[model samples]
Target: MAFVEGTGDEFILTCFVCKNPFGLVAQFCGYCQATRQQALGVERARASQQIISDEPEPQPVHNISSEVNTPAAERVKKQKPKRQNLFFQNMRLRLDNFKEWQIKRSKPIGATASALFIAFTYVVIQTYIFVNTAPTLDAEKYLYPAVTHEVSYFDASNSEPATAKTDIFPVKYLKWSASSSDRWTTKASWNGWTGKADITFTPAGNLETDRPVLAQFTAQYSTYWKVFRKITWEPASPAAILKLSYPNDKNLTIYFNGLAAGSISNPAVAAGSYQMYPGPFEIKFYNLNTGRLIDKYTRTYFISTSGVFSPSYQN
Candidate 1:
C-alpha cells in the first residue's frame, strides 16, 4: 500500500490493484498501470452516496393555522429591539438640538430683557418726578396779600399845621408816585383833621420812600376834640398788619405761620391783617403761569401793640 500528504479534507489514495498512491502525480497507477481518473470517479460517487445516507430525515410539515394557534410559535416571534433603539435615538437628537438652540439665543434674549427693564424703570422714575416734585398752580394759596395800617395823631393848641404836634405812624403799602398820577389815593375825614393819602405800587418796579408831608390845614375844635384827637387806621385791638411791597402787578399767594392763608391778584397794594402774635412764618413767591418758584422768605417776627410787619421785594 502507498499514502500521500494532502491538505484540507482531500487526500491522495493508493490504487487497490497496484497498492500504489503515486498514481495521483500522474495520469495512471504506477504499479498496475491503471487509469487514475476512472478510480477517482468511482471513489467520488461512493463518498457522495455515504454523505447522503448519513444526513437526518426531513420531518413532515404541519398545518399553518395550527402552528400559528400554538403558544410556543407566538413566543418565537421576532422582537423589534432595533425599532425601540431608533425611537430613543430620535428623542436624544431632539434634546441635543434644543440645547444648542438655547445656547445660541441666550445672550440676545438676556440683553433684550435687561434693556426693557431699564427703560421701564427710567420711565417710571421720570413720571414720578413730573407728577410729584414739579410745581403746580394749585399751590398758589401761599402768596396771599399782605396787611397794612395808617395811624395819625393831632394837637389842637398849635395854630399852624407845621408848628402843631403831629405824629405820623409808619404805614405799610406806602409808596411814592410821580405828582401827576391820581390812581391810588384813599381819602377820609375825622372830627378835627382831613386825611388824604396816595399809595403807588408796582411789583416789577423800584421802591421809593413814602414819608408823609404836611400841607395847608385848618383846625376845628369841639368839646370832645382834645380827647378824641388820636386817629388810627387799625382796629382797636392789638393786631399786626403785614405788608408786602412787590413791584409787579401779578397774582400772589400768602402763607401765615407756614400755612396757606389766601391768594390775591392785581392789587394796588398787597396787605393783610392778623392777630398780634409772635411766631415764625414763611413766604414763597411763584410765577403764576409757569408754576416756578421765584423767591422765598422765612423769619421769626414779633408784633407789638400797633406794630407793622413789612417785608418788601422787587421782581
Candidate 2:
C-alpha cells in the first residue's frame, strides 16, 4: 500500500510496508522489505518507448547546393580578401620598377662622370710636365753688345818722322760679307779723306772655305788726290774666321749680339772673318724645334786699331 503527501507544490508516496513517506518513483521501502520492481520496470519501459517515439524521422538526401545554402555552410564558404598579400605584391612590383629605373639612370651618368674625371686628370698631368720641363731664355746672351774701337794711321816720306803725313780716322763699324765677290770691306773717313777697300781672303791648300785665310787687298781713295793702292791689308783691329760645329744643322739657330744672325747646314757653311767692336757680346745657339737653348758663350771681343777681332770666352 502507498499513500500520498503534498509538500508545497510537490507530492510524495508512503510505502505500505513501513509506513514511510517516499517519492512516487521510489524503488524500495527502507523500513520494510518491499520492492517496486514492477512499477519501476513499467516506468523504464515507458521511458524507452518515449525515447523511441521522440527520435526524428529520416529525410531524403539533398544535393550540395541545398547544403551550401545553410547558414553554417554559408559561414564556412565566406573568405576574407587577401588585401595584405595584394599590398605586398604591389610593393614588390614598385621596388622592381624602381631598381630598373635606377640602373638605367646611373649608366650614362656614371660613364660621363668617369670620362670627365679621366680627361681632367690627363690635362693636369700634361700641364704639370710642361711647366716643369720648359726652358728659360738666357739674360746675358740677349742683352750684351758687340765689341768696337777707334783707329788712327800714317803714311810717310823717309825724310823725317815728324814731317810724315798722318791720317786720323775712327773705324767703328764691322761686317762679314755674304757675297763671294765681296769677301770683306773696311770703310773709314777722317779729315776730308774717305776710302773703301776690298779684301781677298784665300784659304791655304786643301783647307776648307771656312778656314782662316791669308788676306790681301786693294784700295781706291780720295785723299787730296785720287790714290790707287795694292798691298797686304793689315788693320789694327783683331780678327778671326769663325765656323760652328753642330750635330743637327737644320735645327740650329745662331745668335750674334742677341740678334738672329744666320742659320747653317752641311755643304753650305757659315764662315766669315769678323772685325768685331771692342766690347762684351753674346753668342747663343738654340734648337728652334724645342725652343731650347743648346749652347751659350759670352766673350769680350777686342778689335784693335789694326782692324782685327780677337774673341775670348768668359764661360
C-alpha lDDT values of all predictions: 0.39, 0.38
Best by TM-score: 2
Off by over 4 Å in 1: 1-241, 244-247, 266-275, 296-306
Model 2 residue runs over 4 Å out of place are 1-248, 266-269, 296-315
Superposition error at 131 for model 1 (Å)? 64
1-315: candidate 2 lDDT, tens digit per residue: 444565532326554333455457556644443565522332222222222223354465778887767788345666788657888889999999998988889988799999999988866654454333211111111111111122211221111332222222113112322212223222222111122232222212222443322222222222221322222222322232222333445666666655665564532224433322233334566776786876543333422213433333332
RMSD to truth, every model:
27.1, 28.7
Question: Each candidate's TM vs. the true structure?
Answer: 0.20, 0.21
Q: Candidate 1's residue-wise lDDT over 186-284, tens digit each?
A: 222222233221222322232333322211222322333333332222212223345544435356554444444455464433354333221223455
lDDT of 2 at 243: 28
